[model samples]
Target chain A: MTEPKVKDNDVVVPGEELASGMGYLPGQGTYRDGDKIRANRLGLVHIDGRAIKLVPLAGRYLPKSGDVIIGKVRDVTYSGWIIDTNSAYRAMLSLKDATNAYIRKGADLTKFYSFGDYVVVKIFNVTSQNLIDLSMKGPGLRKLEQGRVITVDPSKVPRIIGKEGSMVSMIKTQTNCRITVGQNGVIWISGEPKNEIMAEGVIRKIEREAHVPGLTDKIKKELEKTNKGEQ
Target chain B: MTYSKRLDGRGFEDIREMEAKVGVVKNADGSAMFRMGKTIAYAAVYGPKDLYPKFLQDPERGILRVNYNMMPFSGMGDRVRPGPSRRSREIGMVSKNALLPVINLTDFKNAVVDVFIELPQTDAGTRCAGICAASLALADAGITMRDLVASVSIGKIGDKLVVDLTYDEEAIKDMDVADIPVAVIPSTGEISLLQMDGIISKEEITEAIEMAKRACVKINKVQVDALKKKFEVKKNE
Candidate 1:
């Protein structure tokens, strides 16, 4: 029989022993040395059947295919734009993938996507070496305008979005604001100044308390309190 | 006369009081503060991001760069020069090697992870404290590390062996003092760093290393707790 040292959902540090036996298998963020499984990162330990996994508490964003991300045009290339995906790797948005319409070879691409402009786009392909290709033809993929952007820890994005987008939807309807959350942790809010501030505040709150239990309820209550305060 | 009593009246194996806190630097990816005796070390971890000056990029894996600095007025001696000095550069090099073994940077090829360790105040064992703080910050930043590195200064002051030595202990006049700063990987009892000054007999040095190993285990406990406390605070609140 395997000996499990930590229970599920327990916070573990690097090199901390999670279990001591071959009955359990090591998963992400964990490795087996001899008969002991040790944590390789600072995160929550999860024991699932025969394998143990980890959920990181904080980390930099690593781009993956089919993820909706917010990027800034760092350099306008000859045939595409170099986008900083707020990650270690930069992404390329070729002219063909930039839009549906055809354009001349020497045409100015800045008119479509200029430098220092933030856009919400979908990553279409990612090479093993982390060369990312982006596409702007999908829905809600467009340049962000005048509203402010806030970046939080990429690891907390899922908590801010909630299950099936319920948390975000509630915030949208309650604050009466339009918000787009990028997988890269960059979020855009567009609405009246006061309401937009409230939306941003609520999102920030979620990011801070992402590790705590019953977060969805606490956030809903917070939004209600703020809404009542305005009236 | 044999050095029977510590100046601060602590036991031979006892270390100074330690305090550790994580996530103190809000803007940094990961940050921490560690205190030992009167010394304080604040470390911030940034990156695994793009490394510029293309010549330095490594295709195999990312590089770890550590910069250990002491504020001009924070030194135990005279005001330290504001920038990198011969002493600080050596400490920085060892600190990088101290932490490099545990981190896996293969996923971040051509990138860099920079650790900046700043000391606001110090009594002794400042580099060791800085290494301890750097370990906590790396964990707080969620970097993939095989283990945490815990460090301390184990010394032989006169005829007595000690776990951690203060400036007064190091400055004792006409005493046969050996200040040995050691960094150990707690899990494996592996020494990542070892440096010494003054004199120590072969048998005594071996014994001091054994003591450092145990002291490291204690320090590692504090580092682990600092990382967990970052999460526990949220639950309590």
Candidate 2:
């Protein structure tokens, strides 16, 4: 049987003892003491391998090509409705991409999108000048309903979702929170009090120590412990 | 002199308690921090990152961008904004010019190098101080360059040329005659950057240039001493 080694961030080299029963390779270094613990690539340790890599499952809000993000309408102009994509650059929902009907040259565009409404739209393109073009004519893309929104670092969205939706599915089963993780680092969590609290705690914990190893197991243990206590 | 002013028991031409330190920002590609009397500046260097978009890439030398920012508390009063304002833009240009001669940008093709200057306190002659700080930062970042650049500001007050000006002296003093600002590579005695703002005669400018050059040579020694101290401290650490 292979030994499970702990992975840590400070280890500059691979095969170093990260924690108890855990070792880290510099890059996607791996060992399978009992289970397959292999690294796929090298990056800053987001979470220690011994623990569950609890990626905060929130909808990614980063402006990317083909991502349908929910943005707040900030301004209305003759050409388009400016939407705040929660990025350094604002996304413009042009009248042309917004609807099939022609937006008059001098009509009140605010009627289409009020200041506070959350509109779901796909990013068609992002110019080098930081101009973002948004299109709303897509499936599962429209105005967002009432739900609290949260944000995380855009880089960590993939981890929150886990490989093939494993991590997020676990959270959904455990907490019953109807959560959505955006590519732009935004998360929408809506559910019962107990479920919302559990999800929020899990997400917050992930944000604080995503660089540590063995995050997945740690999160699982905590959640299981909480569940058992409730029973 | 019409207005007799004394600083630290020295005449008008004297410089204040000046010191330089290198390798201050460990994470930066290169870094140097300095305190000229009350003035303090930290400089960091990054890149030869590839110039974005092939069109912006230079065929010959790399593009150099110098950013100078004064911390809100860099002054005696309120804290400042992070981004560059008008004053910082002017200083940034001067700093870039100061380091130009020492850097052989042509060596790094299609690249862009950046220098960031953070001034925690502003006395006088920050431009020159920034130039000197940036050169050391560049060296620490391990960027290949011809030599270290040193800068000194020579301001005239009541017919005497001061090596480094203090805040009060710079503001109240009538610099009707232009002051000489020069950055030099002391090793080869090559001029990197030069500017004069007020209206001084050609003869006065020439004399001020000579005076500024001499001050920079002295300042360069301080830069070397600071680097040696840094290495000694690092060895112990």
Candidate 3:
């Protein structure tokens, strides 16, 4: 029988024994050491069925393909744009992938997307050489306007968005704010200044408490308290 | 041997009072502050971001750079000059090497991780405390590592071997015999950094290493506890 050495939410350090035996499979944040699995980082242990994974509490974002991210246009070349994806790798968005419109040679690309403009885009490809390709042709992909952006731990983005976007949608409806969560941990919230600050606070709370069980319910209660205070 | 006793009235194998806290710096990716008795050191880690200057970028693995600085008022003496001295540079290099073995740099190709350790107050064994703080800071920054590095200083005072020499003992004029500092990855029982000063017999050196290894196991537990406390979940409030 497969047995887990650590229970869910147990804080584990590097080289700590995670599980033993052939029935268990090592997952992210874990590596097999002989007949036992060991944690490769400081994180919380997560046992899911036969797989044991560790969820890191800290670290920089590692960019992957097909992830929706928010980045600032760092430079605009003749054919493409260099975007800062908040990771070690910078992303490139060609004019063709950025939009469907046909463009003539020598067209001014700066007019379309200039320096320092934050855009919501999706990663189209990531090469073994760490080269990243991004595209703006997707639903809700556009330049961010009049929204204050805050960054959290990128790994906590999933918790902030919740299952099927329920958590974010609840925040939007309660505060009546437009919220965009980039997989890279960049969040843009636009609404009344008061509501925007409230939304930002709630998002930060989620990021800090991502490892806690029943976090969704806690955030809901927090939103209710703020709603009552606002009325 | 009559004057070799520690000022604090502790046993030869006892370490100084050690305390570690992570996420001390708000702006840093990861930060930790460690205190050993009266000595205090703070470390902050930044990046895994792009390597700059172009010439130093490694294609296969990330480069690790460590800067160890001691404030002019950190010790009880005529003020030291602020900035990197020859001594600080040597300490920084050894500290960097101690951490390099554990950090998985290949995962972050063409990037750099910078660790800055500041000695706000120091007695003896400051480098060991700095290493301890740097490891916690790296872990807090979420850098993947094979294991955590822990270090301690073991020295021979007259004929007795002692762990974690204090400032007064380190400064003792002609009385102290040998100062050995060792950094190790406890899980693998590998020594990443070792330094020996003064005179020690071959047999004594082996014994001192064994003593340092035992001390390391205790220090490693402290490091792990600090990391766990940083990420511990708080009750709903």
Candidate 4:
């Protein structure tokens, strides 16, 4: 077995050799050339047993099925609504998957979700041709009310949400704000003016320091400080 | 008329004082500024976003567009017009071709990636520097690429072959030589872009290509270093 040349968290550039031998399968962000596995992007390298992959540091969001995303209604067609999911590929929200209500033909679709309204939707399907289909019938998926939206690095979404929902829940409890984080890097916060600002600050900090070790602890400390200030 | 041999008092094989910085344009998705001797160039990348004009959208792969431009006062002579002249258009086309193969366009199907290269100071090798900066910018954007493209120009002066020609060296109308600018993907040893001017024999072309390849290896190292520095972790103060 050939050992991987780079360990986890080690930064790698495109075309850098990861491993050269049999038994080492090329994974995401890596390509195979003969017996050598080489990186095809700039990012941190991860070696899992016999598989090697790279997680890119920065990139636009690529829509995937089952991902909960925040989308803006760009246009409303007769059959569906064209949604911008903060990705290169736009998503379609058919009237069937959009809501459970029955609607007559030529009825005003804009009455349901007007142009520029943000909707929390889940990607139901992403075709090989990059066509995206979204669903609004899922739980916690609906139109966003009055709130401020901020964008972050899409790759940092996992960090912002934390392991499970601990970090986001902690922020919500401390700031008394309702927050919804989209997997596409858009965060919606709604609460009292003061609490909303506080939540925004905490979320921005997470986005900025997402790559740092022990980030959860750091965020916890910061939240504690803010809580004390409120009292 | 022997005049200081060449500008900057460097040997034929020596490149100019080169430096690069990534993320120079904060608002851009990715950006890089590169300097080769006195020539300065900046490149910014936007998208993999939606392609407008519905007609131009390709169902198979993303389209890569490069716009190469120069500031009105960048040249040594009178101010150049601030628009897409014939020269800029040609350079943009070649630059786009140079970068097309390295990027994984299929990853962002039905999208477009725009690269804008702007030269604020003109010299002999602006296009080469632009390619270098654009490559860095693309990598900074985290676009999946097979390899970084490194570019340099080799010019034959009198009886010697020189790397990275200066403005004065390029303007010599009486010299019997060739000025060859080449961009290469060093890892794969693939020539992505190549342009030549003046007269040269086949043997010289081969020799020049080999020399450019060696120089590209060095340039690729610099590009990697700059990227590493940009993403380097800093300890808490």
Q: Judging by DockQ against the true structure, name the best candidate.
A: 1
- Pairs that clash in candidate 4: none
The runs of at least 3 residues in candidate 1 whose Cα sits more than 4 Å from the true structure, single-residue gaps closed, are none
How accurate locally is residue B140 in candidate 3, as Cα lDDT from 0 to 100? 83
Cα lDDT tens digits, model 1, B42-129, are: 9999987898898999978888999999999997668888998999999999999989888888868888989999999989899999
Off by over 4 Å in 2: A1-231, B1-4, B78-82, B173-178, B234-237
Query: lDDT score of model 1?
Result: 0.91
User: Each prediction's DockQ?
Assistant: 0.83, 0.02, 0.68, 0.67
Poorest 10 consecutive residues of model 4 chain A by lDDT? A204-213
| lDDT string, candidate 4, A1-231, tens digits | 767788888878888888899889999999997788888988888888788999888888989999999999999999989999898888999999998898999999999999999999999899987899999997999999997888888888888888899889888888888999998988899999988988988888887776687888888898898789778
Answer with 1 or 3, whichever has the higher lDDT: 1
Cα lDDT, model 4, residue A141 = 96
Error at A2, model 3, angstroms: 6.7
Query: Model 4, DockQ value?
Result: 0.67
* Residue B83 alpha-carbon offset, candidate 3, angstroms: 0.9
Where is the poorest 10-residue window by lDDT in model 4 chain B? Answer: B228-237
| Model 3, span B1-237: residue lDDT tens | 555567789889999988999899989999999888888999999988988898898887889999999999998886879977899999999999999988888878888999999999988888999999999899888899878899999998887889999888887786756789899888778999899889989999899999999999999888888888776635333
Quote the lDDT for A124 in model 2: 92
Best by TM-score: 1
Worst 10 residues of 2 chain A by lDDT: A10-19
- Candidate 1 residues A64-120, lDDT tens each? 899999999999989999999999889999888988888888999999889999999
| TM-score of model 2's chain A | 0.65
